[model samples]
Target: MHAAVVHSFDELPRYDTIDVPVARTPDEVVVDVLAAGLHPRVRSGADGTHYTSEGTLPMVPGVDGVGRTPDGGLVYFVASDDAPGTMAARALVDRRRSITLPVDTDPVAVAAAMNPGMSSWVALRRRVGFQPGGSVLVLGATGNAGQLAVQIARHLGASRVIGAGRDAQHLELVDALGADEVVSLDGDDAGDRLGRAAGDVDVVVDYLWGRPTEQAMKAVLMARTDRSRPLAWVQVGSMAGPEIALPSFLLRAANLSVLGSGQGSVTTAGIVAELPALAALVASGVLTVDALAVPLADVEHAWTRPVRPGQRLVLVP
Candidate 1:
């Protein structure tokens, strides 16, 4: 079998021939990889920067993908931590960890949208118990995942959705994607603009966690009309930076609760349980994303290519 092999943590993966993976458990079976997403999480694993990286060598790097089972059924599978990934001609998949997809499902679309789209879906549905009629603010609305977050928030019944990001060009498109308002985090008045637009939002899906998160957090907290109202800040990604200098008073003064939604925070079963519904939305065109599909042989080139805002890369085998 051939795969995108990560030989070194400092470099990009190369297209190389590797041994086919074998199922080790009764519930596990080998599936032919159809399409796999080149997501930021996969990049982190390939570069050995993710928290879960074990510094293993000559490894395949993919978290989830669409594949074909032995009986000619299509499925979307999540790779387990201890097994080889889905960026290959064939991958080991656990039956319990996968969901059967409709025969007519588009493999490329599912592979491209699932992982990124799942972040916000699982966060609101499982992590925070977000209710209908609530308002949401997406902190990094320009990125691929953030763009999906904007749409997902509205689809999940958000009364009003506000998108705030550093890119002016992407911010312009958020309104069309269902955001009630958009704020640009580009100039000197970015903090003020964010506060005024999103201060009273019921939920915040924050992807930028560095200086932007710090400034935005303070701005929203200070501008809230009712400080005692509960505000759920769900941290999904750290596109800007990892750490932030958080003021203690912000937590004490307002009803602000900061939590994370990701692999460790949410159970694998919980994440998988939400996938069928999210995948259905993606298939029905309710939750859509711009995808660039490339052949698996060109994994190296696609890895280096610059992806446009709100676009994702899918590697097809």
Candidate 2:
């Protein structure tokens, strides 16, 4: 069987041959890999940077993907951390962690949208007690997950959705995706603009969490019409930097709560519970994702390619 093998953390995964995966438990089944996404999480795992990395070598690098079972049923499966990932021609999938998809589902689209979309989906649905008619502000709104957050927030019944990011061109696309307002996270007045536009938002789905987040947090705190109003800041991804210099007064002065949403914060069962609905939404075309399908043989090239904003790369075996 052919698979993407990572012999070292320093080098890119190579297209190589590996033994076929065998299911070891009754709960697990080997499925034919239809499509797998080249998500940032997968990249981090491959490079041994993710918090969940086990420091294992000669590994495959995929978190979740769409596959076909032996009975010809289509499904979306999440790969176990210790097992070979879904980047191979065939991957071992735990049926308990998988969801059955419609026969007409597009594997590439589901593979492309699920992981990134889940970041915002899980954050909004599980991380906070979000209600309909509340306003939301996405900090890094031009990226793939951020763009989806803008739409997802609106679909989940947000009265107002504000998208703030640095890309001028992609920010326009974010607006088209259903953001009620767009603010540029650039220039000297970036914080001022974000504060003015999103100070009153009920929730914030933040993906950038470094200086940008620090500046935005203080700006929002200082500009809120009523500091007593509850504000939930759900930190999803740390795209800019890992740490922020949070001041004690910021937390003490307002009704602000900052919490992270990820593997540890949200349980595996919790994430899987929401997958069926999210997959249905993506499959039904209610939620849109721009995906570029690349052959598995070109994994090396695809891995090295610069990621374009708002576009996802899906590997087809």
Candidate 3:
């Protein structure tokens, strides 16, 4: 079968003939992949520069995808640890890793929305005790995952959702997705701009890292009217760059709790178990997918697009 493969780090991705392995155990499931999600980590790992890089080559570019099996074909998986990505015509997944969805479930919706969708979901539901009326600040809130962060925050019952991004238009789009307020990070005085935009923020869900990460942290620090209540900061992505140098004073003074929300860092078993609940949310329209569809043959080129303003691409095989 044809599968999208990254031949080498820094080289463009390409398709190759891959022999799909047979299920060696009863627990294993074989699938015909229909769609795949392009994540930033997939590109970084493909380029051999990501933190989790093992210098692997000829890797399938997608980590999460929508797929179906031959029997019944009703259930599918969204993420895989050792399972094949959806960029392939045929893939083998651990049946346990797959999440059953409506056969009519929009794979693009699942693909475009799932990873980031799950990140924000996990952030609020697991990391922080996100209250019904609390405020949320999403830094880098327009990237594929970042946009999902804002949406999921709203679905999780955050009273006010604040989005921060590089472009004004992107922030506007995020606002449309239920962000009560949006902040633009690409500015001469981004700190001041963000400080001005923040409104009664109780929880800060941070996906921006490096300078923006520090800058957003400072913005949260400056916007705090109440100093005693803990402001939860959920760090999901580091697309701006991953070196975080947080001042100790923010945590000390505000009693702030900053969390690391790595999608894969958590056990795969936990994610698999949670997928059913998440799938139900998707089926009910609580979760929405904003995606651009790309042909699987063009996987290499699609991975190169810049992330911003609903740049999530779903590979249709």
Candidate 4:
């Protein structure tokens, strides 16, 4: 199988050939590569910066993909925890964890959308216990995860969904993605912008954890006018940076619940269990992914480019 192999952490990946392995377990399936999602995590893995250094040398880097099995079954997978990912001519995954795809599904869109889509899906549905006719506020709304969060909220019947980002251009695009309100993180008065846009959010999904995130956390905590409930804040990623300090008083006083959500601690079985319902959502068209497709040969460039908000880069592996 042809793949982009990373030999060293600080170096670029080189195209190479490797043997494709057969599935040893009945639950595992071998797939013919089609397309895979290129996220910052891929680049981080290639560069030895992704959370941990488990991805040793001679590894293929990609988190999720959409493709066909050796048996010609179409499938899509979110490889958030499965490393040596799907950036190759072939890859293997547990059949129980795979999402069988429609015969005519677009791999580029599905592959690119899978990871971020899953982030929002699991966070909103599982972590926050999202319900119909609720409200959601997405911090870093222009980023890939944030943008999908907006769509997912609306798809799940969020009465009001707000997109909070740093730019106008991305804000407009997020609005089109189904955000009832768009707030800028780069304006003169961002807090005011957020306050004016979404009056009082029921839930907040935070991706950035630096100053922007800190402010957002503070805003929601301090706002006495917002709708009060069992307020839940799900923190998925820290694009701005890690090491955020939270106010204990606000959290305790407001009965705010801040839960850290990610794929590392989540089991493959959990993902498998959710695949069916998620696939149904995908098939229904209520949820759509925003992606940028690139050739596998150009994986290097994709790694080098600054990731655009809500832009999932799919590689034709």
Candidate 5:
């Protein structure tokens, strides 16, 4: 079998022949890889930067993917934190960790959307306890995950979805993806604009943390018309930066709750529980994402290419 093998954490994965994965436990099942996404987490794992990185050498470097079993059952699976992952001709996955998909589902799109899509889906459904017809503001709404967040929020019964991003064009694009309003983060008064737009928002799904997050927090604080109204701030990703100096007044002055989602914060079963519904949405065309499917042999080149906003690069094995 061939796979994207990582010999050293410092170097890029080399696509070449490697030993096939063997199931060591009774609960594990081996599935032929169809398409795997090059998510930022996967890249971080390859670079030994993700918290889950095991510091093991000579291993495959994918966290999740869509694949088919020997009996022709289609499934999406998440790899164990320490095991060789999904960027290969085959992967060994725990049966409990895999979700069966419809036969007609597009494997490439599912592979591309699941990880990024899960960031917000799990946060809204589990962590923040999203209410039906509630208003949502997505802070980094131009990114792939943010775009999906807008759509998922709408699908989950958000009455108003505000998409906020630095890219004007991408913000416009998110409007088509179910965002009721779009806010640009380019101007000096962007925070003020965000405050006004978020005045009545019930939940905020934040993908970018740092200056944008700080601005959003200030905006929320400034726009609070009713201090009694509850607001849940769910932090999913930090593409902007890792740290922020949050004012203590923001928490004290309003009914605001800050929570982080993903990995250790959300249980593995909790994340996997939402996949079936999400996969159904994607398969039924209620949710969609722009994906480029490249051959596994082209992993090196595809990995280095600059990803456009809202676009995902999927490796087809």
Candidate 6:
């Protein structure tokens, strides 16, 4: 079998022949990988930067993909944390972790959308318990996940979706993706712009948690006109920076609740439970993703290429 093998953490994965993974337990089944996404998480794992990285050498680098079983059953699966991942021609997948896909579904789109789509879907549905018709503000709304967050928030019944990002061109597309308003984070008044947008929003799905987040929090604290309405600030990713200097007054002054929704915060079962609905949405075209499929043989060059915001590079084996 062939795979994107990571011999060293400092470099890109080499496309070479590797031994096929075998099922180690009765619950595990070997599947032929059809398509795997080159997500930020996968890139971080290959670079030994992600917190979940195992630090093992000579291993496959993908975390999840779309594949087919020996019986020709198509499925979307999440690979084991420490096992050879989904980048290879053959991978051992735990049966329980795999979800059956519809026959007409686009495998590459599902492979690309699942992880990014899940970031907001799970956060809005499971973590914050978001109610329909509420207002939402998506921080860092230019990235792939953030783009999907804007759409998901609107689909889940957000009356008004506000998208905030640093890119000007990409920010223009957010309104088409269901964001009622968009704000730029590049200027010095970025905080004030975000604060003005944060007025009375019910849920804030934050992906960038650095100075942008600090400014947004301050803006929300100052601009919120209603004290009775509850506000849920769900932190999903820290693309900007990890830490923020949050003032004590921001929490004390308003009905704001800050919480994180990933890995430890949301259970594995909880994350998996939301996939079927998201997959169905993708299949039905209710949820759309911009993905480019690259051959597995081109992993080295494709890995280093610059990816535009809202576009995902998928590897087809």
Q: Clashes in each model (backbone N, CA, C under 3 Å)?
A: 0, 0, 3, 2, 0, 0
Off by over 4 Å in 3: 305-308
Q: Model 6, range 197-292, lDDT digits (tens) per residue?
A: 877899999999988898878877688788657899999899989899988877778888989987778877877788899999987888769999
Q: In order, what is each prediction's RMSD in angstroms?
A: 0.7, 0.8, 2.2, 2.2, 1.1, 1.2
What's the TM-score of each model vs. the native?
Answer: 0.99, 0.99, 0.91, 0.91, 0.97, 0.97
Per-residue lDDT of model 3, residues 1-317, tens digit only = 78888787868788777778578789887787788778776677678877766766667767777777787565646535554456787777777778778877777777667776777777777667677877888888877677777877787777778788888877777888888887777768888878777734777777767888787777767676776767777777777777888788877777677778675556767667667777777666775566788888887778776544566888888
Q: Give lDDT: candidate 2, residue 276.
A: 96
Q: lDDT tens string, model 5, 1-317? A: 99999899889998988888788899888999999999988998899988766688887988899999989999999998756889999999888889999999899999999999999999999998898989999999999999999999998899999999999988889998888889998999998888888788999999999888988888877798897799998889889998899889888888999999989998888888888998888778888788999999999998898988989999998
Deviation (Å) of 261 in candidate 5: 0.6
Every candidate's lDDT: 0.92, 0.93, 0.74, 0.76, 0.90, 0.88
Cα lDDT tens digits, model 4, 13-89, are 77778888577778777788888887766777778887765756778887777878877888887553443578888
Which residue window of length 10 is worst by lDDT in model 6?
Answer: 220-229
Off by over 4 Å in 4: 79-83, 196-199, 226-228, 306-308
After aligning candidate 1 to the native by TM-score, how far in Å is the CA of 311 from where it should be?
0.6
What ordering of candidates by lDDT runs from best to worst? 2, 1, 5, 6, 4, 3
Candidate 6: stretches off by over 4 Å: none
What value does the lDDT take at residue 21 in candidate 4? 54
lDDT per residue (tens digit) for residues 1-317 in model 1? 89999999888898999999888989999999999999999999999989888898989999999999999999999999889888999999988889999999999999999999999999999989999999999999988889899999999999999999887887888778988999999899999999999989999999999999999999999999999999999999999999999999999999999999998998899888998999998888887679999999999999999988889999998
> Regarding lDDT, does 3 or 5 come out ahead?
5
Instruction: Output the worst ten-in-a-row residue range by lDDT, candidate 2.
Output: 78-87
